[model samples]
Target: MNEFQRISPQQAQALRQQGAVIVDIRDPQSFAAGHIQGSRHLDNHSLHDFIRNADLDAPLIVSCYHGNSSQGAAAYLVGQGFSQVYSLDGGFELWRATYPDDTAQSPAE
Candidate 1:
């Protein structure tokens, strides 16, 4: 199943209820600026590095500025044997449009 899977913002909310992990692939600076609540910061360029250092069993929800990089990330993770991984359709921009309170911006970045 190498095909890229996209989850609607609505589906994402439902998955979040079951404890899916949201991975914001923006840099630390961008991530600190704002992201989906409870999202972890992981740079796409350093995917393998970060994945090696972090837990891999979790269901990862990859995201980016407009839903491109995260889709790529999800594909890579799936190839790497991550059974459960997904990309948020339309990225954080759509997420914000759908959820205001569920999202928050970082003060520094």
Candidate 2:
């Protein structure tokens, strides 16, 4: 089994610009409050669908509230055959603070 790498929010942002797929593992309410722009919410409810539909080789970045949980999520994704999985180091809080303009609230919320 391969381990996922931990990257700073700035590195994650660079990955995003290169078309990495970002997935937020936070609860629905938290995710609805704000998230990285273009990130997909992949909580327990939607994880299965996402896994089934997502390309296995795509660069996948996982983020949680404080970055801790995202490490586990990133590992899981890598185990599921995602070739390039990364855990965002500072998660949503860091991202929000670092690049507020790159964040977006859930429009459907």
Candidate 3:
């Protein structure tokens, strides 16, 4: 596993307020169901394929369903020259559970 840094929900929320890009690194099918408002979707399963077609200059906040995939995404982003990159501390499940009213369930596949 990579030794990248993670940001807390509150910290993610704060950075989000400043226009950071929350990159939901789940499958497109999962993300289309539900996502943080304005989050960009890029499935972590194929980061190498999807990354080449992404906006790399923005502040990135990567997330998976439970924070696992995000570590890889963060590390990948760092390697691609992303200086301000972070993985959500607990992923989407935690985010939704923590902010119950703030988010909704993802669509079923």
Candidate 4:
């Protein structure tokens, strides 16, 4: 069964306001460049730990560079028992363009 929904950046914003967990599947460098405020970087290396610590039932919004990659990531999260999963329709690029003020640049570590 399809376990995730694909939503626009605007819809994502609304979900975020309601406390949805935003997960960026982009590479660390891309994520570091910019991402939705409060989004966690969840690439392959950090995915396991994230899964272990995350609330499976909380709404999860998955995003990639563009929207294409997020669908799979969202589905995987759902397969792992996440009850609510959403793929950002146009991904981070669209989000950044649509809501520039909603983004945050990650400080160099």
Off by over 4 Å in 2: none
Residues 79-100, candidate 2, lDDT per residue (tens digit)? Answer: 8889999999989999999998
Clashing pairs in 4: none
- On the 0 to 100 scale, the lDDT of residue 70 in model 2 is 95
What lDDT would candidate 3 get against the real structure?
0.77
Clashing pairs in 3: none
Report the candidate with higher lDDT, 1 versus 2: 2
How much is 99 displaced in model 1, in angstroms? 0.4
Worst 10 residues of 3 by lDDT: 100-109
lDDT of 4 by residue, 7-108 (tens): 999899999999999999998889999999999989788899998988988899999988999999998988988899999998999999999999998999
For residues 28-56, what per-residue lDDT tens digits would candidate 1 score against the true structure?
87778789998877864766686787566
Residue 90, candidate 3: Cα error in Å is: 1.1
TM-score of each: 0.84, 0.95, 0.77, 0.95
For each candidate, C-alpha RMSD in Å? 2.2, 1.3, 3.7, 1.2
lDDT measured at residue 32 in model 1 versus the true structure, 0 to 100? 81
For candidate 4, what is the lDDT?
Answer: 0.92
The best-first sequence of candidates by lDDT reads 4, 2, 1, 3
